[model samples]
Target: MSTKQRIAIVTGANKGVGLAAVRQLALKYPTSPLNTGGSLLIYLAARSPERGEEAVQTLLDDAQLREAGVLVQQGGSVTVKFRELDIGSAESVAALGEFLKKEHESGVDVVINNAGIALKGFDSAIVRETIRTNYHGTLDVCTTLLPLLKPSPQSRLVNVASISGMLDAYSPAIQANFHAAVNKGSIPAVTALMEKFQHSVDADRVEEAGFVKRAYGVSKAGVIAFSKVLAEQQRQDGVVVNACCPGYVATSMTEHMDRPGAITPDEGARTLVMLALQDLDGKRGEFWREEKVVEW
Candidate 1:
């Protein structure tokens, strides 16, 4: 590990936007603002080892990468490696932390929490699982790996949120609570609100409780809130934490929807790649889409 080498980890990168983000990172790393004349080591993480490795191989065999000598390490090249990680599993998250600790003593430069679930339904069980994976699981990964952040301007944490997660989707009271929780910079407070939403689902009173009936949307809202809280808390640490919506991309996650104007996975990954590797000029704790900060 060279002292100048920068390390990044992308979760749920086996396919879709996650994989596209990984690809863009590798292709852009050498010229990225954060590059410092050293290799950019990227960990493409997924729950399945076989799929993760396959993704790694795909990157290694990309014609563009090969033409640019990125795979051959001609200059400030990129290295894509496979790491099995299931963010929904605490044990798996912990194992990834341990591996990072051992492999990169210099600390991690970037973390993109893209692993999430969007089940089709409006029941308590569906709500619980959606929140558990999208919000809680993402939160767990952030907390577990926060200690390893490099603590520099180059350090970044990008949480893959959605426009559906915007606070305006909820009632005024519920939106106010989210704002209050984020202003307080309390992860627990935000988490409690998520729990309240879940309970409301069980009681068949989501709208009555001021929450929307969309579980995926509510969970993403929590992610946006948590991102703000984390950004406030990590201001001094110099880590740029922001949430982003990838738009309606044509991926496995959105195949069930009738998205006529859906963008390509590579196109949807542009903002994510920008946030991960571009110079944000000290931007932190905001929501972005199409490479611009937007209201969430």
Candidate 2:
């Protein structure tokens, strides 16, 4: 890869918003002789390699895209390589880190931590897997990929959070307490609240705690917290780390349920794409909703 070519990795991109983001990136960074440098090198990493390959091939085979030179850029085209990455598995993440280090030697400019689960399949197992993949897994990937991000002059890190994770939406009383903790910079207090809610399942008090959706909300809240912490740590490195709530997007995740004011996959992907391309100049650690920054 050339110095001008920006490399980005979007996890769980086999379908939905993830796939849409890859398509937009390819289109925005097209190949032309007028543009001397390659625009972007994208890794559409998915949990299933076959699905990932198919997604990339589909983009490559698009008739309109081909005619418009959407996927190709400069001397090199937008190569969508498939890599199996199971965020729930630590072993998988470690192996992926090693693979990227060897193959993408120049390192990645952007890391969109987009692989997430809603915990809808199981009872107890669902809750456990949600926290593992959404919170802990994201942290593992960040640490493992830290070296890859260190070299970039314009590095970006985004955590796809949810409005349901907003403390105010939970309960007014709880929000009041959380606001106090936040004002005091008490991260431990925030973490304790999450732990309390997660443990509520054990006592069958999750509903009482305003965790009717339970694990999904808690997991996304963890993402928001993680983004804030990471942004503080990497602010000086020119790494803009932020989180966004892609408001009730209509996708497979919400196919069975009733959704109002639901945006299309492209709408969700656009928010993420903007974050990926945002100029660092101290716009770090912001929590956004659509194009606007929202209060945490």
Candidate 3:
């Protein structure tokens, strides 16, 4: 079985870490039980098919890595495939679920919700859009893909998150002021955190909330909470759902920053891919870094 035949889906794979994840998964199929299935069936789900195909072509044309890039398992050989998937839109998410179900009955072995947008600068619209895509869009993808995940021998769901969302990231001033509300012994505290963030954005007072990078932080915090919720929801189904901080990868998303200690897109993708195909019985609903489980 080649990678082209085994069933896997990667969202927002047109470029960056998403594309790198597709590449690494294709390269790694030979070591998996899925490899024997011939042609690992990869649905390179992206918002735009044109952009997705271009990314694929880039992989295909890369001389040094081409041989390991697009291999898919089909008829015992690997070939990569593509589909249009826009997680930010509910209709696109639903359509993708139907498309994959109709095309592959057994369900996909892995699904990576790698589509993300950053609200890096101080802008309310950017914040709203980031929340819409990073948090809501990811949930849409998970729920839509739930049925397809049920029958797999082993299924993994990986949500790409960031450390900026961690409560620790906030300054002592803000955390101290909000600790009682946020650290209360309930999910409502977390919910309140989201509400407060949204309110800040709505009121055009993101700076007051210490959210210089407003939407991105709020969205990722949602991911941390969402992952725990998903772990609880899917615990009995034998499916693993986990979130990961891919470190600061040097990609288009971070092009505006002049930062050191940033890893390559491929490096970030490897961490995500590791979570996407990790051993379910061992760790589920956990946050991971470099393939190691980390604190929520």
Candidate 4:
């Protein structure tokens, strides 16, 4: 790889918003304000190898991508590769980290934690599974990849949070705990809160214990909180950490419901692409939606 080449990874990118973000990143990164005439390398990571490879082929065959000057061919300024990554699996996440470390000596420039699960029902098992994949799994990926992040203004870590994760959805006491955990800038503190939420769910006292009964909501809340704490911890390293709400998109996660106003996958991915490639003027930790920072 050229010294000027930039590398990025987008997890759970087989379809929907994740795939759209990968396409947009490849299209925009070359001419981005942060770019200075370098090749852009993006790893479209998905849990299924077959699906991941298919997504890469789809992008390569896209007429719009070709017309827009994004060439997946050899000697192109942009290259998209498929890497199997199951964020929910520690071994899978570790394998990706090791591959990057070995293949790209320059290190990784961007990481988008888009791999998450939202079950259909609410129960102790459902909540456990949701938190396991959304919160703990994401944290595992971050921890495993932290060493590979190149300390630069362009380096970014974007966590795919949701409006459902907004702190206002929780009770005041739960909100207070989140606030304190973020203030402490400690991963353990935030994790403890997530465990407490799970315990509440197990005991069938989520609302009474100051937490929302929605499993997805609580998991996303943990993601937002984790992003804040991570941002504070990585401030000195110049890695921008941010969480974003992609809006109500008509993706598989929400396909069961009829949302009239839900945006397209491309539209939902705009903010994510922006965060990955645009210069944020030194903004460190923030919750973003539609390219603007909003309260969580």
Candidate 5:
């Protein structure tokens, strides 16, 4: 409840990259007398409350932190509080916004839009579902929570994007729009692009239309675009919005994937943690890969 406590929310944090990122953020922001103006309180959000709390208990039980829900020691004062969140659900997101307003009077400090689902292969079985969660869901969460983030002195919004989301996924025409209006949050354009992609898929001409062949890649492209548009839209706000590609992280999502050079989830989270701690005024909107900003 102290003004010195920094609050954060990480979506889909039950396991894998999301879970790892939550742990790293907690460790990075812990309060210490030498560096303290604030202690970190991370809300590890998962689809199920039971799963969310279990993940929190895993963090506490693993002896990684010295306490739960409060600071117990320097460098270990961070606490991971579980909260149920399913970004894909409008009802769920509305409830979370209300809860944050009531629980944290000031606003949220950090928002790691890490909840994402990637469906490999070019099939209709999951194309709609992927877009529903990764694109529409992420946008919903951001739109609902932007108000809460307005109060932080240096708030940060890091969207978990992917290398596969490179602009080349789209045609020159589509890519030009994204690059031309670099500082505008074109939510309508993004929505239109999503619709176009779906249409291409429905017509079975996705590849012919200059969009990514797979649903996963296109969805991530939406995320990368969202970060840019959001950062551009909120140019006056005291916050940073950046997209990070954690490489091919070794998680369940990628277990069946035959990709090379995949790193552990914890290793993948380091850059995300670094981004979260950056001065909000320093980097307004950037797409990053392996700790360095890359062209999107």
Candidate 6:
């Protein structure tokens, strides 16, 4: 590794916004404000190694064509390593921790928690799976990887949340619990809240609790809360964490929608891409929309 090398990892990066984040991140590192001239050691993680490698190759080809010779050369051959990571699985999350320990002695620099699912149909099975992957899965990844995210300035974690995760979407009581838990730095309370939401789903009474009826939105709300809580816990370590809306993106998740105004995958990835490269400037536990902090 070069003296200016940065280790970055992006989950669910095989396609859509996740893939775009990985691509733009490769370009961002060479010119990142946090580490000017830094070469990116990007882990383009996916649940399937085959898909991840394919995305890596596609980005590599794009870089060569788009920058001619400037990008890879200036960045000292920006490397993309693929890892099979199923964030929904605790065993898989543990495997990622071990892999990082083996790969980078200095530890990770950037993490984009982009691997999440959206369930439009609220089957009992579907809602649990949604919470498992979006809320608990994200929570597990952050907790497991915090120790590996170098305890220094300029380190970042970008959770790809949605505007739908807006706190107001929850009832005032649930919001109070979330804020109090985060303020107190109690991750267990956060976990319990997420489980409570799951139980609401089981009871088919999410609306009664003052939450969005959709499991996808509810799950994302959990992710947003977890981001804030983890940010508080990691603040002293100089690690900046943010939860940001990726915007209404035209991916498989939204392909079924008969609506207009959907942005391309690349456009949707802008907030997340920018978040990974920001200086943070003493900010933590922020919610962002298009790179600007929002009141969510």
Candidate 4 Cα misplacement greater than 4 A, ranges:
256-258
Candidate 2: C-alpha lDDT: 0.74
Off by over 4 Å in 5: 31-36, 66-76, 180-184, 256-259
lDDT of each residue in 33-124, candidate 2, tens digit only: 21336566788988987899999887787665676675653223666677889988999999989998887787777788888887555356
RMSD of each: 1.3, 3.5, 3.9, 1.2, 2.8, 2.0
Q: For candidate 5, give the lDDT of residue 193.
A: 81
Q: How well is each residue in 90-170 modelled by candidate 5, as lDDT tens digits?
A: 999999999999999988888888898876567665888899999899989988888888544367788898898888757
Model 1 stretches astray by more than 4 angstroms: 73-76, 256-258
Against the unseen true structure, what C-alpha lDDT does each candidate score? Answer: 0.90, 0.74, 0.73, 0.89, 0.78, 0.82
Off by over 4 Å in 6: 1-3, 63-65, 68-76, 256-258
Model 2: residues with Cα > 4 Å off, grouped in runs:
30-36, 73-76, 121-123, 151-153, 171-193, 207-213, 256-258
lDDT of candidate 1 over 153-271, digit per residue (tens) = 78999999999998876789998899999988899999999999998999988889999899999999999999999998889888889999999998889873556778998999999
The backbone clash count of each candidate, in order, is 0, 2, 39, 0, 0, 0
Question: Candidates ranked by lDDT, best first?
Answer: 1, 4, 6, 5, 2, 3
Evaluated at residue 172, the lDDT of candidate 3 is: 63
lDDT of 4: 0.89
Q: By lDDT, who's the top model here? A: 1
Displacement of residue 100 (Cα, Å) in model 1 is: 0.5
For model 5 the local lDDT of residue 25 reads 74
lDDT of 4 by residue, 228-251 (tens): 988988888888899999999888
Error of 6 at 46 (Å): 0.2
Q: After superposition, how far is residue 175 of candidate 4 from its true place, in Å?
A: 0.5
Per-candidate TM-scores read: 0.97, 0.86, 0.84, 0.97, 0.91, 0.93
